[model samples]
Target chain A: MLLIEMFVFLGTIAFAISGSLLAIQKRLDIFGVLLLGLTTALAGGVIRDLMIGNIPPTNLAEPQYFLVSLLASLSTIIFFERIKKFNHSIAFFDAIGLGVFTAVGANAVLSFEYSQPFLIITMGLVTGIGGGVLRDVFVQEIPQVFRKEVYGMASIAGSVALIISYDFVSPIISLYICLTVTFTIRMLALKWKW
Target chain B: MLLIEMFVFLGTIAFAISGSLLAIQKRLDIFGVLLLGLTTALAGGVIRDLMIGNIPPTNLAEPQYFLVSLLASLSTIIFFERIKKFNHSIAFFDAIGLGVFTAVGANAVLSFEYSQPFLIITMGLVTGIGGGVLRDVFVQEIPQVFRKEVYGMASIAGSVALIISYDFVSPIISLYICLTVTFTIRMLALKWKW
Candidate 1:
């Protein structure tokens, strides 16, 4: 559980930074930057919770989520030049975040006692990529998941791995394996321009 | 209830047409057109339901909503020239749809036993403009509600009227008044470019 929470935290910060950078590029005001950052980090979970009938969403219920995203966004804006120079580092962290989020998302569905592989995988993919899709849309661009590389595909692959391995291995082990596979796929896609 | 349903239907079709027209202008493929149309027609309700903890979203559960949006989108694509020629007619319907949706959204929140005027009004405005926001975002532009002439403000006006009048009039009568006020404001905005 602690490991999962850590993953969620890391993912939140990574996604928030990505959103802030995009918002800055789009020349949005500070409020828009923060708003987009929060949306990109939390909207996916909110959407997932809503689909599963969870009210108010965990993001809304917990201020930490919002604070973390806000801080990350502010940091990105403050260290714009350094961050921009470390583009590869950002992409690497983003891949890890994607993997962790996919695993966490799948695990969330499992806790709901939904055993259907399709549903689990779908939920996981949404949880992983949904925020990015929204962030891209907010900037008035086609979602990168739909247009470029293997972003959504990598998340789906990770989700599939997590769901399929749930019965064969311990949940924690399954999560680690899922994260490894997803991260690898995303990194490879970025490197190879696939 | 019957009258509310009729308004919802009208709003759905009108929003769907607007979505399809925008998609066509963006040169989206057929699938993209349909997807945007459905998103524009139903995403607001979905967002509202999620915030209120309604599961699965009535929009997803009801096939009629999907079908109406799909048919509307198809018609727009097929009769592009004719629809383009009837721009005024489209705007007229769109205004009516906006009014009805604003009323319906406010009423939905009221049913949830939430008496907070601010929350009710915000939800109402969201329910009215959320779909259009999503549509605009999908096409890579600032939301019309944020940029255009009195779009979201008109919805807010309608929402405020609905909430304030709830004590003085029957819900039905309140809805009618809300609709008329919203429609008038939107049309006047259009006419005067407010």
Candidate 2:
């Protein structure tokens, strides 16, 4: 549980930074940037929870996640120039975040006892990519998942792996396998421009 | 209940036409146009249902709504040039849809037994404009509610009216009041370019 929490926290910060960077690039006002950053970091989970009948959502009920995202957005704004120079590092963190989120999303749906593989995969992909999709849409661009690289595909693969292995392996081990597969595929896509 | 269902059906078709028009203007592929049209017609209700913990959403469960949206989108495509000529008429219908959706959204939340006025109003505004917001975002534009006319303001006013009158009048009567107020405000905004 501690490890999963850590993964979620790390993913939140990375997603926040990515959202803030995009907002800054779009030259949105401060409020817009913050709103986009927060949306990118938290809206995915909120959407997922809402779809599964979780009212109010844990993101709203708990403040730590919100604060973490806010802090990351602020830091990105403060160090925009320096951060831009570290694009590769940012991408690396983003890949890790994507991997973790895909696993987390799959695990979440499994707990709901949804036996349909297609639904599980859809939820997993939505959890992994929904935030980025919302952020891009806010800035008036086609979602990157639809137009660029293999982002959503990688998440889908990880979700499938997690679903397939969940019954046979320890949950922790299954998560690690899902994370590794997603991270590798995403990183490779980034490198090769797939 | 029948009257309310009629309002919802009309709103769905109007919203779908608005979405399809915008999608055509954007030169999206047929699939994109259909997706945006369906999303604009249904997403607001979906968002509302999700927030109130209505899982899967009635929009998804009810096939009539989906078919109505699809029919609207197809008609918009087939009569693109003719439809474009009737921009003013379209705007009027859109305003009516907004009004009906606002009332329906407020009424939905009222059943949730939420005591907070702000939450009810927020839900009402969301239900009224959420579909338009999602449509604009998908097409990579700033939400009309954020920039154009007094769209959100009209919804907010209607929501406030509905909340205040619910205790004093029958739900059906309150809905009519809300609809009239929202429609008047929105039409005035269009006329005055507010």
Q: Pick the candidate with the highest lDDT.
A: 2
| lDDT, candidate 1, B1-194, per-residue tens | 59778888999999999988988887876766776788899888888887776665677655688789989999999999999888898888889888988888888888888878888888888888889988888788788888876887888899888878889999999988888889999999999878
For model 1, how does the per-residue alpha-carbon lDDT over A1-194 read when each residue is reduced to its tens digit?
Answer: 58778888998999999898889989999999899988989988887777766666788899998999999999988998889888898898889878988887777777877566655665677688889888987677887664554777788789888877878999999998888889999999999987
Error of 1 at B170 (Å): 2.2
Interface RMSD of each: 4.6, 4.5
> Stretches of candidate 2 above 4 Å error?
A50-57, A60-64, A192-194, B1-46, B54-125, B138-140, B144-194
Give residue A58's lDDT in candidate 2 (0 to 100): 68
lDDT of 1 at A168: 99
CAPRI category for model 2: incorrect
What does the lDDT read for residue A7 in candidate 2? 87
- lDDT of all predictions: 0.84, 0.85
- Residue-level error in angstroms, candidate 1, position A134: 3.3
